[model samples]
Target: MNKLMLILLALSLLCPAIVLAKGDVNLTAPAKDQALTKLLMTRHSVRAYSDKALTLDQLSNILWAAQGINASGKKRTTASARATYPLQIYVMVKNVTGVDPGIYLYDPQNNKLTPVPKGEKRTSVVPDAVKQDWVAKTPAVIMISYSKPEKDLGDKTLMFVSVEAGAVMQNVYLMCEALGLGTCAVGGYDAKAAKEFFLLKPGEEPVLMLPIGIPAPAEPAK
Candidate 1:
């Protein structure tokens, strides 16, 4: 194990509350081949969302698909460079069944959400970050942040971290498609404003955001 892994292990052991046990919600086993292929073919960036609320099961599945632990020994659905796993997932909930409106951090290990301060601020920050009306109106927004990597790792760390973020986002896109939900991966945002809005720690930076919800009806073809 290298320095980063050792640091992560130490942190996990020290901060048990941040790590969670297996998810209690029962999830239907995913059909690997057929469903995945179909979803890929149908998936599209959806900017408009309906007022439908999301269920706990759907939220659980989406979070799992994003970066949940898939294997033993804390392995995740997405790969991390040297298992550094520098990404943090936060959900801004506007309308989720059984979940109060707020911002919550995804605890992948426990498969739960830990509430964060300023949940109502989600709307105010949306315009500052991306200035997109649809994004602020979505039922939920998943924000992916890059926690600073070790300085000794040098500049290559940014590239690896970005690739990891993309992998997680793709997983989310495919999962949303399978769930009959709509989402758009948003990269056009003010990074500095996001950092302050989300109350990110020093060195942590917001990388991407996904606005997700039930899709609005498609317009009739002309």
Candidate 2:
């Protein structure tokens, strides 16, 4: 096996907690200015989705776009205030190919998905959270959560976390647009219920939920 494959295999064997769903890390890098500008101009929220299933590579790219290591020093794709990356990413998988339906946490360090229990509980709360049918029907939902910062930071911490979540969500949107997929940022959820459902630690709060899928076909012109 190649060196990279060998390393990935080793990681999978060592980390039993993470379900190392194979994803293409070597995504085709896009040109900086023109491509990015195009993506930004065309990106839009998509609430309706087709039945097509998302591939593991697509999921990996989406997660990586949110907070993957960008620099040699392990800086993230999204910036953080005081480098306090309090945001955590969780995904609810419902119709992804090659992955079981469940809730999984993104391990940026390892680039793997770690399964968590009680993912189905999210279904019961989707309507209460957003009151939108699409939220429950999307193939997957990416949730950005915040772990309470040190008490010393005070209320500014919430501001920083919220900004960081915005950055992460924007990255996901741009990535989805580039990948020809669709996603919507949803904030109309019951935070308390989501926190409890996700079994978050004390002070951890679910900040935003992004429902993603293959967008439905455009309506025919009149």
TM-score of each candidate structure, all chains considered together? 0.79, 0.78
Q: Considering every candidate listed, which one attains the maximal TM-score?
A: 1
Model 2 lDDT per residue over 91-189, tens place: 888888899877888989888998876665343337555678877768888888888755446768878888999999999999999999999898888
lDDT, candidate 1, 1-222, per-residue tens: 999999888988997644566764545555656867688777788887788888989988999999899977599999888888899998888888888887888999898998887655454446777788878667888889988765445778889999999999999999999888888898998989877766676778899998888888871222
- Which TM-score value belongs to model 2? 0.78
lDDT of candidate model 2 versus the reference: 0.82
Please count the clashing residue pairs in each candidate, in the order shown: 2, 0
lDDT of 2 at 99: 91
lDDT of each: 0.83, 0.82
